[model samples]
Target: MYNDKVMKSALESMMFVWGEPLKVKDAAEVLDADKKVVKDLFLDLQREYAMMGRGIRIREVDGAFQFVTHAENEIFIEKLCTPVKVKKLSQAALEVLAIIAYRQPVTKGEIDSIRGIKSERVIDGLMSKDLVDVAGRSEGVGRPLLYKTTGEFLKKFGFASIKDLPDITEFDDIEEYDEETPHEQLSINFEGDADSEDK
Candidate 1:
C-alpha cells in the first residue's frame, strides 16, 4: 500500500507529466487507491502550493488538477522568457464560443440560429485550438453533431468547472447582428517558447 507521503509524491510527478489537468479517478486507478483519498491528496497538494507560495502552482479544475504558473509571478516569468502569443480570438469566435460554452452539448443548428450567422469557420478554429470539441451526435432530424467546451476552456477562463459560469441573462434579444470582425481583440498569453508556427 502506498503511504500518504509516497502517494502524494507520485501524484506530484504524475501531474507534472500530465501537463493537462489530471483526473482524480484516472490517478486513483493508476495508483490503485480510492478516488476519495486521491482527491483529498490532490487538494492537500493544492493547499500546500498556496501556503508555500510556490512559483509553479497547482490548480484544480472540476475534479482534475494541473500545474499553472502563479498569477502573481506573471511579470517575472514574462521578463525571464519570451511569452508565446496565441492568436487573439475574433469577436465572432468569442460569440460562438460563448454560445457553445453556455449551452454545451448544443447542436450546430442551435448555435447558428442563436448567432444569426453560420459559424463553420469559427467552430473549426475553436476545435483546432482545443477549446471546443464534438460531444456526440444529436438525435434530431439529421443527427447533427453536438459541440461542447473542453477542459482547456476551464483552464483558460480560470473556472473550476462549467458550473462556475456566472448567471447571465439570456440572449433572446439578439434579433439580427452583423457578422463583422470588430477591432476588439482578446489577448491570451500562454507560457512557452515562442513558435513561428503560431505566427
Candidate 2:
C-alpha cells in the first residue's frame, strides 16, 4: 500500500519523466491506487508546487496534469530561446533531419536503409534539440517509433508549413539530398560542440 507521501513522490516523478500531461485515471492505474486518491494527491502537489515559488508548476488541462513553467518566467524562457542559433546542423544531423522532414512518419529502419548507416545517435541529437519528435509507432514487426520534424523545425527552416517544402519534383532524387560531403561540418552557437560526424 502507498502512503500519501510515497504516492505524491511517485506522481511527481511520473509527470516529470513523461514531460506531458497525464490523466488522473491513468496515474491511478500506474500507481495502483484509487482514482479519487490520486486526484486528491495530485491536487495537494499542485498547491505545494505553487507555494514553492519555483520556475515550474503543475497544472491541470482538460482533466490531465502536466508540469509547466510558471507564467511569470515566460520572459526569461523567451530570452533563452531567442539566442538559439539557426544554422548549427552537422552533415549527419542535416541528412537525418532532411530525411525526417521529407519522409516522416518514417521509422529508424527506413532511415538507416536510406542513409546506409545506423542513425540512432544523430536521431537522438535531433530529438534533444527539439527538432524531431516521435510521430507514432509503426505497425511493422517491431513497432518501431516513427519520427517527424516538429513545428520548431518549420520555424527554423523558414517553412510556413510542411506543405511549403520544395516540391519533390525539384529534387532529382531524395537520396541525392543525403549526399553531402562526409567532412562537411556546421556547429550551433548555443551547444558549443564539435560538428556531428557522418558515422
Candidate 3:
C-alpha cells in the first residue's frame, strides 16, 4: 500500500514535469511502486476529485494517463494557464491540409482538384515544416508523389498517434477544430540537397 505522502508527491511530479501522457507502467517505474499499486492510488485520487468536484482530474486517454482540467472548469483553467497563441491558417491551405490528412497517400493533383488551387506552395510549406512527407509515389502516370503526416506533426499536436485524432462527427462542428492546426508547414528532404551533396 502506497502512503498518502508518496502518492501525493508522485501525482505532483506527473502533473508538473511529465506534461505529456504517461502509462501506468512508466509511472510505476518512476515512482518505484508496483503497477497495480500505482493504479489503485490513481483510482483513489480520481474518486476523491470526483467526490469533491475538483477543477482538475487525471484522465486516461488511449491507454496513456494525464492530468486535465475538468470540463466545467475549462474556462477557469484557461485563465490560469498562459494563453496559447494560435497561428492563423488560410482557407486554401486549410482545405489542402484537411484533404491530405484525411485522404493520405493522395497525390498533389488530387489535392489541387479538391481545393481548386495549385498545391505546390502549400505542399512545399508543409514539407519545409516537416509536418508532411513523401510517403511514396503513386503507381499512375508521372508517378505523382504521395504525402502523409510526420512524427513531428503528432508531437506538436500532442497526439500519441494518428488514430488518436478526434472524431469528425459533423463537418460543421468548430469545437472539433480545437486540435492543432497547420501553422507553417516544414520542408524536409531525405536525400541530401544540392548544398550537402556538393560537400
Candidate 4:
C-alpha cells in the first residue's frame, strides 16, 4: 500500500518533528521507499507549497530539507515573536568565514595559509552558527576534511547561491602552512555590537 499522498503527508509531519534539515536518505529509509522517489516527492511538495503560496515552505540546504516560513512573512513573524539578543561574531571569526566562503571545500591547513593563522576555533564557531560544515575528505596529504558554506549562510548573506558572491582579486603568493607551527595561532579578538540597520 504505497501511497504518494499518504507518504507526503507523513513526510511533512516528519519534517515538523525533525526541526533541523532532514536528510532525504533518512526520510527514504523511514518510508521504506526509494531515495529518488522520496526526493521527487519532496520537490513536488516544494513546488506545491510555492504554487499555493503557503506561509510555511520547505527549504533545501545542501542535500537536507527543512520547513521554513515564507520570506515575505518575516515581518509578521518578527512582530509576533519577542526580539532575542543575538550572539556576536569576532573579527577573527568573520575573517575565517570570508576565507571559507570564497575558497570553500578548503581544509584548515589551506585556511591557515590564506589568513596566516590557525582557524580551528573560528571554524568551530562558524559550525556552531550553522554557517559552514564539512563537505568531505580531500585526497591530498593526510586526507583532511574539506569545509564549505551552508544554506543558512546564503539566507543570512541574502545570496541565492555561492556563485552570487562578488568577484575579488584572489589572494596572491599564499604560503603553505608548515605542519609544526604555521603562523602562530594568533586570534584577533574584537567584538562589537551590531548596528540597528544591520541584520
Best by TM-score: 1
Consecutive 10-residue window with the lowest summed lDDT within model 1:
190-199
Highest-scoring model, lDDT: 1
Across 1-199, the per-residue lDDT of candidate 1 in tens digits comes to 7999999999999999987789999999999999999999999998998899787777778779877887766667668877566566777888788788768899989999988899999999999999899999999999999999987766766667888764445545333323322111112322222211111
Candidates in order: C-alpha RMSD to true structure: 5.4, 11.4, 11.4, 8.4
Looking at candidate 2, the ten consecutive residues that score lowest on lDDT are: 190-199
Question: Which segments of model 4 are wrong by more than 4 Å?
Answer: 88-91, 107-109, 116-121, 127-199
lDDT of 2 by residue, 8-64 (tens): 999989999986567899999998999999999988998998898877777664466
> Residue 18's C-alpha lDDT in candidate 2?
87
Q: The CA-based lDDT of model 4 is what?
A: 0.72
- What TM-score quantifies how close candidate 1 is to the native fold? 0.82
Q: How accurate is candidate 2 locally (lDDT)?
A: 0.71
Q: Is candidate 1 or candidate 3 better by lDDT?
A: 1
TM per candidate:
0.82, 0.46, 0.49, 0.66
TM-score: model 3 vs. ground truth: 0.49
**Alpha carbon lDDT of each predicted model:** 0.75, 0.71, 0.63, 0.72
Show the colliding residue pairs in model 2.
none
Give one digit per residue, the lDDT tens place, for model 3 in 1-199.
Answer: 4586787667767855887666778878877788888777777776777788776666554445566666656556558769766454455655666667667788999988766678999888878877789999999999989998866555445454667554555533433464443222211111111111110
